[model samples]
Target: MTEAAFSIADIPIYGRILLAPMDGISDAPFRCITRRLGSAYTVSEFINTHDFSKLRHYQIARLAFQETERPFGFQLLDNDAGRMAEVGARLYELFKPDFFDINMGCCAPRVTSRGAGACMMRNLDLIRDSFRRLGQAVPVPLTGKMRLGWDETDLNYRAVAEAVVAEGARLVALHGRTNKMKYGGKARWEPIRELKQALPVPVIGNGDVNNLADARRLFEETGCDGIMIGRAAMANPWIFAGLDRDEVPIAEVFALARYQVRAMHAFYPGEKGLVAFRKFIKAYLAPCGLPYEKIVQLMKVTELEGLLEMLADIEAELGGQGQSRFGWEGLANPFEKEQKA
Candidate 1:
């Protein structure tokens, strides 16, 4: 295989894999634990800057990263360049992250219909201005995350990447599908490859990078400088560290589920924490291969104690899947070991 065009991302990635910004799921503790597990960087969960600025008590607790997760960044999505710039300037001053990214690739209907995310790509002039304004307003290197385009017919990845560079964007990350495709079809790596070839600034690849093999191939196949993982972190944050088959038992799925429940309680507080935690448990338990009867019972669980009781009981009945002989260097040595397999 050929060498990666850009081995490390903006400034210096420190590590290889990065955690994607998932709105609710990628909370502070989630990012913390996952970063401890493995990841070069963790982009705070994407939120509309307008919504964030308007929050009366906007803590953005997740943005509080320790010195360890060196090179942190926050991703914000907004249609108005002025708003994006205004917010970018504030975050650049307060957080001083390695970079500030504008989300131009979100596929959510509400986000796109309003002419944001991939939908924003339809207007090249606006897209360019968004970058230009942000680049000028923000202190840190300006960055953007975008999709291929509106759809296959309007595959303008090359033009957009070039324009972002022209607008003074230091780097651009491209999700291979159009807004219309959402997370459906296979990610079009060709666009990433094309963008890599078309732009001087580093091009990062996204979409479907649930595992290390996929990540390795993303850089190799597309010539992207880096890979950003979103849904993959939800199912298994360890993917950034090792393959499911190569790493320790996938049985840790249960443990991760339990941890998330406690984290939600700590992060959210009150009865609402338990409620939101339940929604996240669905993905962790998917590998347990639970029967409908058992799943219904587990799903019905509302409180932390109740959920743990059921999972612990299920653990014994399911042959204790988490027990494994595998070892992680970090877990072993703690200091010398860096992130990756």
Candidate 2:
């Protein structure tokens, strides 16, 4: 493929860094911060096809993103071939993502047991038929994200990958773990390489890309077209900006915490906002090297002013350490003789 031609499965993905659709984490507000941070493209959390057709208000809200988050779209999960296409076509017209992604990868107990998500891999006919319908129904390109298989006992990604493309999908992303593995074992990059070798369409690699080095390594090893990041972005939104990886400043951490609280309030309002943002605090403080529990406690506090106060207190505490904590020498004399002139 030409370097200039960057679209994946018809989705104009220029940067090659895709944000994985994480449940409860890849919401619009979080995505906005991440998009500003590193990834070239972003996607919404996996909304069930059944829920989309039903017009679940919360699910609809999840898809609500600003123009700045463009080249972004929603991921849907379903097994019903007829229903999938019908819903896929409607989504093409109504929401208009860069492309529509089908989730054949999620192994959530509820999703899998019901013959959806990762379970689709076990049934070749359904997988083929769904892609066939989806390709025909949606004017947009059809792409799919899938696991290695349902579990260790049934490693069938090769077949599933071929079937999806035959049914009309132009691109495929492999997550490298079976449904049974969940988040357990290491995500096998070898399988991804094999899939890339097998498929004509570009393959995007997901899983275990927790840092720039990991992203680099995956590209080097798999020769996949791109990398998809998830938990890493949740921890440090500045990761993509190339700032934190070089040198993290105390001010940036404090500002991010405050921004998150304000953004949460704007979206969720009141007590829930306060409760919800607590999930993100510890990652922000990883560089500070504080105890995770202490960070979580600090985050759980509801008062926004109280949270800022704690951050200030922590900074003072850090300063008191006299470079011992951060391993950086303090500026002994601010401007000293140089600025005296």
Candidate 3:
């Protein structure tokens, strides 16, 4: 690994690579599979504070994980200071996570419209207040994830970083872009370098880190303690382990996908599980050398038996492979393309 291992509040993180939490994607099944593949730590999906009173089984399922998924945290999102604290206390009392993280970096319109997520950076005082309240209520270490700010006119990432740490945030993950940038513009790492220089706590740099080379460049460029990956991980879960995606064996990829699918079945049963697992079908197939049209057709197989039959056919077709040249990066998400088109 290019970046050496580090820790957050004395909890030794065995590596410098972590899986950034995504709402629908980074659930227990995925997190557990990635942990075994090599990710150092994983954060839970952003749990909305308001829904705590009447959370469904599936909503709470995000928090469920095995002992192997240790050194994990529960990420809470909310605009109200008191509610954030209340949720923090409740999470500790119920889940007893290793730590707590406040979400200030989500840039979705619905989240920002509510004065949460990236919008939190627009108000430094509220950020500090919320962190303070959460710190007081929870005995574990407090951490935060954020973007540059709301936009260029209100770039207060440094100020927010200073405030959160003062209020007891032991670590911070900064996704180097603003709300307006979303996932479009290039992630500016210079500001992340500046923030790392200013903060006393460990800083994990996030944004646009798609592969091992990207991770190395970010660590070298920003000097942050760690790196967090989001979208790219969905394409290649073994990314953090420095596994060359281009050299991955087709059989190995198929086996891993089967394992993850079985895990999904165990966690989310019947059609619900099959429906949820559909999104990942293309991601897994991206590393297989099958034709795009064939892959697209295979991805449409919703029934578990049909999917397994297709995998068996693919395995037989590619019998001579040491490592298939097909890789995770640059593969198209056919579902996303159909939506946009």
Candidate 4:
């Protein structure tokens, strides 16, 4: 498939580069920052369909978005078609998101234990029924994010995509690996190319796109309508903006990290907000290659004022250095720890 072979549906996917919905990471603050930095589209962290019904505070926080985050979808995960449809209608009335996405690629044990996420691919009947129910319940465009299948032997990417499209899905994002791969090994792009050829709807390819060259390769090779980025975006928030780490100054890194902290504080407030922001510290400072001990020190400073003080102290400590210390290569992805294992 050539770049010319790729085409988008009538739906408003402003740009081809999209921010993938990630649990615990794609919060209101991060989405808003990424949108401003240049991510064409952003998805709310996947919301459990049942939880959407109650509109809990944390769920509400997840759904909250700035006006700048236009042309984004709210991803939903569920096993029961009837309940998904009911909640879809309720969410439409309350949030009115540009689109609603069924999550079929999440590999988390808790989610799969509920027979949702990537587990949905194992049941063709459920995939078809879900699209049907969601289409009937919500008037907005429908989309889905899915892995190739549950495992190597049951590679049902095409079958599941066909079922959803036939049932009324406007778009499909295919993460090249199967559920068994989790975050391990390389993502095969050939399946994505084949899925693009097979489906009438636009197909977005995901997995392992860590830089601009990677984004171009995904498009040039698979001819996917767009590319969705996950973990890589965490390390470099300006990734979609075409900004490389070499171009970013140490001061700007601190500024961006501080801005994210401010947004988290504004949205959540008090101790809860500060604690939630802790997860981002490493990713924001990834380019600087902060030492593990320094990172641990920074992570332990939970309070906003204390965190700022720590950041200043670290900057002063590295003031005369010509280049940053190196060790990021060995850092564990705190976000994907459970899935990677």
Report the alpha-carbon TM-score of model 4 versus the true structure.
Answer: 0.87
RMSD of each: 5.6, 8.9, 6.6, 7.2
Compared with the true structure, what per-residue lDDT tens digits does model 1 show for residues 87-109? Answer: 88887787787777778888889
All candidates in order of lDDT, best leading = 3, 4, 2, 1
Q: Candidate 3 on 257-339: residue-level lDDT in tens?
A: 66666566657645665677767867866766579788777757777788778877887787734432333223222222111
Instruction: Write down the lDDT of every candidate, Cα atoms only.
Output: 0.72, 0.74, 0.80, 0.79
lDDT of 1 at 178: 88
What alpha-carbon RMSD in Å does predicted model 3 have with respect to the real structure?
6.6
Off by over 4 Å in 3: 1-4, 54-58, 287-289, 320-341
The lDDT leader among the candidates is 3
**Which residue runs of candidate 2 sit more than 4 Å off their true CA positions?**
1-5, 55-58, 243-246, 291-297, 312-341
Q: Per-prediction TM-score, please?
A: 0.84, 0.85, 0.89, 0.87
Worst 10 residues of 3 by lDDT: 332-341
Count of residue pairs whose backbone atoms collide, per candidate: 0, 1, 0, 0
Better of 1 and 3 by lDDT: 3
lDDT of 4 by residue, 1-341 (tens): 22333333454555688788899898877887778677877788887987666554434576676666767678889998888888888778887887889999999998898889999998889989998988899878899999989999999999899999999898899999999999999999999999989988899999999888899999999988888899988888778778766666676566666667756766774576678777777777765777788888877776878887887777676562334222222322222211110
Deviation in Å, model 3, residue 272 alpha carbon: 2.3
Worst 10 residues of 4 by lDDT: 332-341
